[model samples]
Target: MTRSGTDRRLSDDEMASWLPLIRLVQLLPQALDRTLREEGGINHAHYAILVTLAQDAEAPPTLGEIARIAGLSRSRLSHALDALARRGWVERTSCSTDKRTGSAVLTEAGRDMVRRAAPAHVAQIRALVLERLSDDERETLTHLLGKLLPGIESAV
Candidate 1:
């Protein structure tokens, strides 16, 4: 049998590393989304936005900054913020530093939602991931993924 020039295949070691990560990446978000929606009445993306806003108590970052930190595109963040705003969880306002820019601020209701969701969300995460790992394994995984993120993010 002849192989095509473009038909590079995954080696066993690569598959061993990548296959599980691929499955986790694909399914974990859905699981988290479901849990957050059921327990907190919000999906994961909206939850992420709320968390981003909660990071700074005194002032909010601009939309672009939130996009960078949350790993969301501008449009996605905007839409999520819109949903949150409609729910009285988030409010977008003109940035004080840059009037042309906008920032998202978490409302009291939003902070309460995050507080309510955190315990369940954390439990779900532990059930799905952390419980399966030894502490050392978890630390190693975090180190490895931190090293991997820059390359992956740059490609996007």
Candidate 2:
């Protein structure tokens, strides 16, 4: 391909590695959302919030913390919190010590939702990804992705 001097295009070998990663990044979320919505009436992001809250059941994390962990902006997290609250799956409350600080608590129904939805989600992940890879392939992919994550996180 022709390029101007300033254009530093990827080499063929780089494209070979990047193309599949790009496609997987683009497609996997849509596929997960479809299955999650079909199975539980919530998209993957909402499910992720539920799972994260479950992980910190003893002390609910603040909205900012949840947003950071979930890679969502504060505004996006607020919107999601509103929806989850409406569905009776979550309750958002201001911290007693600092009224300006807000945290999310998963309801009993939220736990129930996670319980009912986890099986289907796990199955879809397995079918679409894990089952397709050998043990060694899975390990290598995990290592490579882990190496990439710091840069990705920093960019965000």
Give each model a TM-score.
0.89, 0.88
lDDT of 1: 0.88
CA error at residue 146 for candidate 1, angstroms: 1.3
RMSD over all Cα atoms, model 2 = 3.1
**Deviating ranges (above 4 Å) for candidate 2:** 1-7, 96-99
Q: lDDT tens digits, residues 50-87, model 1?
A: 88888856778889878877678999888878989999
lDDT of 2 by residue, 1-156 (tens): 554667588778778989998999989999999999999999988898898898845567888888887668899999998999999999998876789999888999999999999999999999999999999999999999899998988898
Total clashing residue pairs per candidate?
0, 0
Error of 1 at 4 (Å): 16
Question: Cα RMSD to native, each candidate?
Answer: 3.5, 3.1
Which portions of model 1 miss their true places by more than 4 Å? 1-7
